[model samples]
Target: MSDQATLEVRNLQTHFFTKAGVVKAVDDVSFSVGKGKILGLVGESGSGKTVTGFSILGLVDEPGRVVGGEILYRGENLVGASQERMRQLRGNNIAMIFQDPMMTLNPVLRIDTQMIEAIKAHQKVSDDEARQRCRDALGQVGIPAPEERLKSYPHQFSGGMRQRVAIAIALLNKPELIVADEPTTALDVTIQGQILYEVQKLCAETGTAMIWITHDLSVVAGLADEVAVMYAGRVVESGEVDGVLDAPQHPYTAGLIGSVPSRNARGKRLQQIPGMTPSLLNLPVGCAFKTRCSYSTPVCEAAPVLSEVAGGRQVRCHHPLATEAV
Candidate 1:
């Protein structure tokens, strides 16, 4: 990983205005990804991980907007950038891989057609040149017989293969940063592992920073260099993956790690965090995890700002769990 950060998100607040009330989809979330490094944005559904990715890409549509903060891509603020500028940057300087492969692939189009279009959209290349680039990208993602796969349609491939195609598209431009939102969630474990390895290798070779958004800690443990845990639209804890996973200081982080099946003994029942995630529109005051956290106290009633608890580690909790206990 390079010393300079490729992307820096500072106090990002993306909100949705509905008839019922305002939904704080991403509130004061902050993190950074260095060149060739991966930051896993882990959180359950509705925790704003996906929203954050969308905000960075300028993809949030009607009724929702980035209300505050800066999304600095190589020192340039993209929050106030023009639509034309964002369009130019989207598939060129930055790319996003959504959870569903169909979101990226057109059912009626051949894989080669889509991939070539993606390349030509940013660069003026000849058809043959674009096709070669497309073939090379497919090969990079471990697709078998790239030449043959390029001629196939979306439906001709399995779920995992389709995802590999989507990933290949994302890598076509060799963007400086990629925000992958659970792209491997539906794949079998073996395929997911293969994809992870390929992605990590790509980042290292190309110096492309990545934000891998998922709820799976095991994936993050193996793939991400840094981890950020989100709750109720805010980052609750963040640090180097090893330190955060082995010695989680935040109660929510601890709960998440404990709930992982491998963390339990051979025959013991898996542990679970009690209570449910609060609704964004009607979230409780202060710490959102307090209701479910065993260490909550009166001080937790007041919102806790992210504070550095140790070197390169931060947690948003009045009474953070002890590292040893975790």
Candidate 2:
């Protein structure tokens, strides 16, 4: 990892102010992504992984906002940045590939029109040059007959095809940082592999930093340089991908690994983590995962702060699991 990171998120707290109560969507979450590296944000749905990505890009809507913390992009804080400033930075310095392709695609606009507009918005490129770049991007993402596809509208494409276009668009400008929220979940295995390879190549060649948010551990194991496992709006554990995945310290992380198909015997039922995630509005007294974790102790009644354990891994647990669990 580089000493000077491309992005550093420190003590981030994004909360939703609802009529019933304030929901802490992302609480005290922190991580960093070095240039030319990928950080996997892995967590179940509603674990605040997606919200964390949105918080980074300044995309959190009203009633939900980054209440605290510093989102430092090369040392520049993004919290409370002007809308105009964020607009100028987006699609150039920073780009986000949302979970929904429609968030990136316009139903009425031709693919080429939207792609060309995106390029011209941040750079001084001629329409012809921009159009060619658009065609090349589509081709790079495994889209066939790029020239013909460019003429088509978003609604004309299948869900998976439209997602490919959305991924293509995110790569068009070659932003320094990309926040992708499960961009490949909709793709078939063959297409997903191609996208993964291309993304790895893009970062390696262009020094791009990325935060790939997904619930799939298999994807993270192969693609990410580092991984942060989140639970109940907080990162419960984080470290190099191999170290964490092979012998997870946090019980939540261990449970997640145990539940994967490859970890269990054939014909046997899958291992399950006990209980459901606690509601953010009515969180327990201390550690959020305590209710579900088998390693919980009296110390867990008071929140266990994320601290470095052996092998330089960080685990938020009063009693972390042993290697025997593997």
Q: What overall lDDT goes with each candidate model? A: 0.93, 0.90
Best-performing candidate as measured by TM-score = 1
Model 2 RMSD in angstroms: 1.8
Work out the TM-score per prediction.
Answer: 0.97, 0.95
Clashes of each: 0, 0
lDDT of 1 by residue, 71-111 (tens): 99988899999999999999899999989775667889998
How much is the lDDT of residue 284 in candidate 1?
88
Off by over 4 Å in 1: none
Q: What is candidate 1's TM-score against the reference? A: 0.97
lDDT of 2 by residue, 1-326 (tens): 34788999999999999998999999999999999999999999999999999998888998998999999998889998998888888888889887766556888889999899889988899888999999999998889999999999998897778888987888899888999999888777777787789889889998999999999999999999999999999999999999999989898999999888963398888899999989999999899998887778888899999999866589998888885647
Q: Which run of 10 residues does model 2 get worst, by summed lDDT?
A: 98-107
Q: State the lDDT at 110 in candidate 2.
A: 93
